[model samples]
Target: MTKLLVTGAAGQLGRAVLNHLLETSKVSPGDIVAASRDTSKLADLAAKGVETRKADFTDEAGLAAAFAGIDRVLIISTDDLATPGNRLKQHKTAVAAATKAGVKHILYTSMPNPDKSLVSFAPDHLGTEEAIKATGIAYTILRNAWYDDNYLMSMPHNLETGTWYTAYGAGKVSNISRDDCARAAAAALANPPAGSTTLTLTGSESLNAEEIAALVSKASGKQLNVVHVTDEQLAGGLTSAGLPDFLVKMLVSADANIRAGNFDLVTSDFEKLTGSKPQPLSGYLANNKDALLSAH
Candidate 1:
């Protein structure tokens, strides 16, 4: 049986990957290992017959042991915003462990344009990607696009304020659904390409702030007003909306880059990887219309 180890299994992307892997494949759940900092959190995965393990990446021994008999390792980017350096260190440890265990492939979920991105979390991804490449293992890099739901979180706040303010003013983003990213990951894990593959996954089309405003207007029936604000205003807005200081700075800078058109490009790489184009944003909205409406 082929054994696949998935780190950060408790996170959204990790959970989505595991769910799709279990639901859509002939591969038995037992052949997959779902690991995280806390084993108890993954009880549902364990109950589904997935081999569950408690492998905190900070603990070198635990990480090394976790890769034993693993055929492929999917390192979902860690979510420690407080100290991303620690997470990158953890990724390095996991890569070493996978290498020692003779794992055939290493898959990573990384940000697009990691090297040049002004995204606050770019360095962690770029460093980890560099490490993975240096390992000489057969690898695949999934440069996931912006998640559409990121806008949904601020819906209530942005609507209440009567302004959908962001530094990504008129910056077109080919945003794809997180579920599509999950499906792409599953496809890669199921039938991984032989050498290193770097995929820039994006939506079917690019959309600017105006397009997004129009969609919001249609989706929620709100006389929602769109305001293209400065990076400073966006930073302040984010703070007012409950973002932490560090994140506010980071995101504001990213929005600046967005204005520069860094994240405006569209790509067919995801379809090439998954053998199908991603589901459209409209479909995502329609499927989750009830949830979106309930937010109001």
Candidate 2:
């Protein structure tokens, strides 16, 4: 049995991937290793007979030790975006540690069109991809689309206010659920391809901001008017709304990326990896109607 390791196993995506590995892919629990900075958070996984290790991206030597004897490893992108270039450095460290550990296969969770994406963090992903490829190890890079669940962060407030502000003028985005991304990641890690490949995992359909607002309105029985704004105006609004400087910049850049049609893409890679169609955005909204309506 191949010993598989999943970094950041305490995070939402990491936990989801581990769940899919055990329940969907039916990988033996003993063959799976869950690594996180705080191993205490992974006590549940440890109870399931999955080996748990302390793997901190900032500590390259520690990571190599944690990756010992692991054949394949999934490096979930770190959320160290507060400082510019810190995230990329963390990723490069992980890649180097994996290479040193002699890991046969490596998997990564990335964003779509990183090469030309306007998102502030695109460079981090692109640099990490280059580093992984530089190692000459068999790799699977899953360029995941924006998560439909991300809207939940601000959608409820928008629904209550009956106004949706966006700068993505007529630009469409194929939003896949985080769960689907996890499923695809698990499948790729469990039964990796024979060689290196980069796959963009996306939803079955793409929808623009107006279409998205309409779907949310219909799902929540609320009147949502899409208010188009300039990037500067959006940034000003976010800043006034008490968002941090880094997040404001990141969100604005994401909208600009969408407006440039970078995220306007659909692919069957998710289905190809998981053998099932990704859940539609419309269905997701409908299923989470109560949460959408009550989210503040």
Candidate 3:
């Protein structure tokens, strides 16, 4: 039996990938390994016969040992966005471990056009991608777009304030659903492509901030307006709004990326991999309206 391990299995994306692998791909639970920093968190997966292991990226030896006997491993990007270069270090360690363990293939969840993206998190991804390529292992790079639910982070505030503040002036983003990204990653893991393959998984529609605001207005029954501002102004506002400096910078960079048109490209890779159209923002908002309202 081919052994496959998914890092960050305790995270939402990791859980989605594992679920798709088992329930949709019909992969044997015994053949899959669900690894996280805390193995105990994966007890449910373990109960289902999926191998559970502790694979903390900071612990190099432990990470290598976790990859032992695994044929292909999916390296989900860490959520530690506040620390500078910490994620890159973790990714490098994971790649080194996978290499040392002689894993055949290394799959990574990355941002769309990391090399060209203006998003603050882009460099870490580009660095990880370069590191993975340097290892000379067969690789699959899934450049995922921003999740559709990401917009919902502002929904609560918008509902109360009636204004959607952004720096993305007339720029469009092809954001896909987190579930779709996970499903595509799971499908790729179950039947990986020959040699190195890089796919950009994006939503079917490319929408601007105003368009998103219009959708929110329709969903919430509130008059929502997009307030476009300069990047510096956006940073200042978010910082004054009680957000941490690091997060303010990250969010500002993401909007700058949108302004630069880095996220405007639409692709059929998601459907090509999952055999279904990517979910639309309307359906996503309709289903999660209540949750969006409570996000504040």
Candidate 4:
């Protein structure tokens, strides 16, 4: 069995990737190492017989030790939205650790169209991708599209006020579920393809802001309204939402990129890798509708 090391094990995507690997792939629990900053948070995974390690991206020595004896490592992008450059350091640490431990394959989850793509948080991902390329290890880059779960917080607000706000204008986004992304990651982790490959994991179709509003309205039985705003207003709103200045700027910039048609198409890359078509927006709405409706 190929040993796989998964970073960010406590996160939603990481958990789903491990679960999918257990259910759908040939990887055994004994061959998996789940790493996180908080080892206590991974007690359940440990109980399942998988080796659990505390590997901090900031701590290179620990990472190198944990990566020992692993064949592949999945580098889940860090969540420090305010500091994009910091994650690059973390990724570099992990890369060096993998190199030291002689790991042959490394899977990285990155943002789609990250090369001067103008998306919020694209620079860090693009930089990390470059670093991974420099590492000389075989790499598989899953350039994940916008996640459907991003709507979760907005769903409650939209349902409550019957208004959905965005800076996307008429630009389309092939939003994908974090679960499908996880499945794709699991598939890649189980079998890291030859060479450095980049795949854009997207949904089955593309939907603009207005189309999503319509779908959300049907799912929630609400009079949903689509309100397109300027990036300035978006930055202000994010600031009011208590986001740091850096994050507010990042989000506004991403909206600008969306309006520029950066994330505006459907891709079959997910299906090509997973052997199954990605989920539809309606399916996500239906499955998550109850929670969205109840939230406020």
Candidate 5:
């Protein structure tokens, strides 16, 4: 039995991947290890007989110990991307540890079109990809596109205000559900192909900002208008709305990418991996209607 370990197992995506591996793939709990900074958060998984280990990205000794006796490992990208170079440092540490541990196969969660993306943190992911390549480990790089669930944050405000602020203009985004991304990751881990590979997991369809707003309007039965603005204007508005400076910059950069058609690519890689169709934006909105409607 291959000992599969998933880092950041306490996080949203990480938990989803582990659950899919167990419930969907029907893998034995004893064969999987859940590694997180706080193992207490993974008590439920521990109760299920899945091993839980504490591993801090900044602590090399702890990572080495946690990675021991693991045949395959998945390094979910850290969430602290706001501080420049902090995330890259964490990823490098993990990659080095995995290589040193002689792990047969390594997986990484990455953003789509990182090399050419305009998103502020794209460089960090691209650099991590380079580091993984340098290690010469059999690798699987999953370039996940934007998650439709992210809209829950901005959509609530847009719905309440009756105005959808965006800089995307007519540019479309192939936004995949985070759940689907996790499922694909689980599938890859369950049956990794020989040698290294790169896959871009994207939504089934490309929808522009206006079309997305239309979906929200249909779901909520409210009148919402897409108010196109310049990236500078959008950043200014978000900053005025009390958003952190780093987040404001990140959102503006993502909009700039959308406007430049950087996120417009729609691919079948997700279906090819999971053997199922990716959920459409409308369906996602409908499923989470109540939560979105009541989000403060």
Candidate 6:
């Protein structure tokens, strides 16, 4: 039996992927390994007979030992953007450790258009991709699009105010749900392609800010107006709201990326992988209406 390991298994996306692997893909628990910095956080998975390993990205030897005898490994990108280049360094360490442990196949969760994306962390992803390729190992790069769940961060407040401020002039985004992305990732890991491949998981349809606002309004029974502003104005507003400098820059860069039409991409990669279409934004909004109304 081929052993599969998922690093960062305690995170939201990692847990979702593991759930799909067990419940949806029907992979045997004995063949799966869930690795995280804190093994206590994965006690539930351990209870299910999935092997839990302490895989710390900062320790190369520890990662290598954790990856021993594993056929395929999924390296979920770390959320260490507080320091520039730190996340990429961690990814490089993971890739190197996986290679050192003689892992046959490697998979990664990346962002859409990392090479040219306006997101501040695009370079980190691009650098990590380059490092993975340099290892000459069979790899699967799942470039996930913007998650519809991301809207929950600010949409509730926007909905409460009846106004959504964005810098995306008319550009659209093919926002996929975290669940759908997890499903696709699980499918790919369970049955990887013959060789290295890069797939961009995306939603069924692309929608602009106005279209998104309309959907949220219809779903939550609220009137939401989209107000367009320049990137500088948006950054200023976020700063005035007391958001940390790093977070303000990331959010503004995302809006700028949308405005530049970089995020207006639609692909059937998710359907190809899972043999099913991803849930549309309308359905997501309708299902999460109560959460959308609860301003954080």
What TM-score would each prediction reach against the true structure? 0.94, 0.99, 0.98, 0.96, 0.98, 0.99
Instruction: Using lDDT, give the best candidate's number.
Output: 2
Model 5, 1-296: lDDT tens per residue? 89999999999999999999999878899999999999999999999999999989998877988999999999999999679999999999999899878888999999988999999999989999999999988999999999998998888888888999999988989999999999999988988867998899999889898889999998877778999999989999999999999899899999999889999999998888888999998999989887668758
Query: Tens-digit lDDT track for model 3 on 1-296?
Result: 88999999999999999999999889999999999998888899999999999999999999999999999999999999899999999999999999999999999999899999888889999999999999999999999999987877777887788887889998999988899899999999998989998999999999999898888778777788888999999888888889998899889999999999999989999888888998898888878888667745
- What digit string (tens of lDDT, one per residue) describes model 1 on residues 1-296? 78988888888888888988888644589889998888888998888899988888777777878888888889898877776478788788888888887889999999789888878788888999999999999999999888876767766556556677777776887788888898888778877877888988888988887787677666766657778889878887788868889788777877776777877878888877777888777666656655555555
On a 0 to 1 TM-score scale, where does candidate 5 land against the true structure?
A: 0.98
Q: Write the per-residue lDDT of candidate 2 for residues 1-296, one digit (tens) a residue.
A: 89999999999999999999999999999999999999999989999999999999999999999999999999999999999999999999999999999999999999999999999999999999999999999999999999999899889989888998999998999999999999999999999977999999999999999899999998999999999999999999999999999999999999999999999999999988988999999999999999898965
Worst 10 residues of 1 by lDDT: 287-296
Tell me which residue pairs clash in candidate 3: none
For model 4, how does the per-residue alpha-carbon lDDT over 1-296 read when each residue is reduced to its tens digit? 77899999999998999898888875789989999999898898899888999989998899999899989999999887766578788888888888898998989999888986886678788888988899888999999988988888677777787876789887888899999999999999987677879899988788888888888888887878988998888777778979878867877776787788888867888877889998888899888888778765
Worst 10 residues of 5 by lDDT: 287-296
Alpha-carbon runs more than 4 Å astray in model 6: none
RMSD of each: 1.7, 0.7, 1.0, 1.4, 0.8, 0.7
Query: Candidate 6, 202: how far from true, in Å?
Result: 0.4
Query: lDDT at 254 for candidate 1?
Result: 71
Model 1 lDDT on a 0 to 1 scale = 0.81
lDDT score for residue 180 of model 3 = 89
Clashes of each: 0, 0, 0, 0, 0, 0
Tell me the tens digit of each residue's lDDT in model 6 across 21-131.
999999999999999999999999999999999999999999999999999999999999889889999999999999999999999999999999999999988999999
TM-score of 1: 0.94
Cα displacement (Å) at residue 20, model 5: 0.6
State how far residue 230 of model 5 sits from its true place (Å). Answer: 0.4
